[model samples]
Target: MFKRFQTKLLQKQVAGGYRLYTHPANASYVEKLVLSWDTRRLTQAALETLAIIAYKQPITKMSISSIRGVNSEGVVASLVLKRIVKEMGREKSPGSPILYGTSNLFLKKFGLKS
Candidate 1:
């Protein structure tokens, strides 16, 4: 479909089908100035916890807290709520603590191939 001047249309997968959105067409030829208002952010603690989970995934909460030298329960919960990390399964330890790993959303958000 067509769009306004200096803009291009792109398709994205929706629940049932594809949806079209506008994007800049003449990126190499045009210099556009716009305000930066991107919101979603992560704290230092969250970032540290995320790095640990990304590198050494399928790990338990205690393991993460032990490695980080602080309680990571809140950070992990926030990551899960953000859909970046997920519950993979339970560890075979005595308590059978839940194991956490990155979600598909994390892979896509970071542009990493599964």
Candidate 2:
């Protein structure tokens, strides 16, 4: 596919031993890129929420609370705010609580493949 070719091109362009040079503008870009890539740059709450969601996906906030033994609402909100997790629509069950999953941004940030 075109995507595979693009990946190969990018890999060729940024071969081994490549490095980033930091000037004022490049430094700013680097900072933003690093923040986007390093999920750890997120708050502790976000990290915890992300872990819970990753491990127990398709789970509700109440279930998360039962497992984590604490309210995870705020942490979930922060992850959504940071574009790390996204609403995957709603469950078809009684409450119709929102479902969520990590976004492509999360994979890109963490250098993970789908």
Candidate 3:
């Protein structure tokens, strides 16, 4: 009986998957902390790379570099480390370059519905 009750009370499914819900009091505390947390600013190159990837997702590093007129490897790596971008897949062409795209975290961070 306890197990059944716990199962019903603990989790709820959203578009992505099931998420554990916190108690109302704890939820408020966590929300406040998250709102107050300070995030480091991205570098100019990182910001430029991120913008390109966000706008033209599923794009490759070579394409980004071409558009920016500079090497974007380090910037892309930084974005990936920050969980702002992710590798989607390889492009269907010679050498099959890896494609980059924004993550779900990107949408959440930017307060996007999709």
Provide the TM-score for each candidate, comma-separated: 0.64, 0.61, 0.64
List model 2 lDDT by residue over 39-79, tens digit each: 55777767777888877776677777777788988888767
Q: What C-alpha lDDT, on a 0 to 100 scale, does residue 46 get in candidate 1?
A: 85
For model 1, the local distance difference test gives 0.82
For model 2 the local lDDT of residue 84 reads 82
Provide the overall lDDT of each model, using Cα atoms, as 2-decimal numbers.
0.82, 0.73, 0.83
lDDT of candidate 3? Answer: 0.83
Candidate 2: RMSD over Cα atoms? 14.3
Between candidates 1 and 2, the lDDT winner: 1
Error of 1 at 100 (Å): 0.3
Off by over 4 Å in 3: 1-40
List residue ranges in candidate 1 displaced over 4 A: 1-40
Pairwise TM-score winner, candidates 1 and 3:
1
In Å, residue 38's CA in model 3 sits off its true spot by 5.9
What TM-score should be assigned to candidate 1? 0.64
Q: Tens-digit lDDT track for model 1 on 18-45? A: 9866565645333233112121477999
The segments of candidate 2 whose C-alpha lies over 4 angstroms from its true place after superposition are: 1-39
- Worst-scoring 10-residue span by lDDT in model 2: 4-13
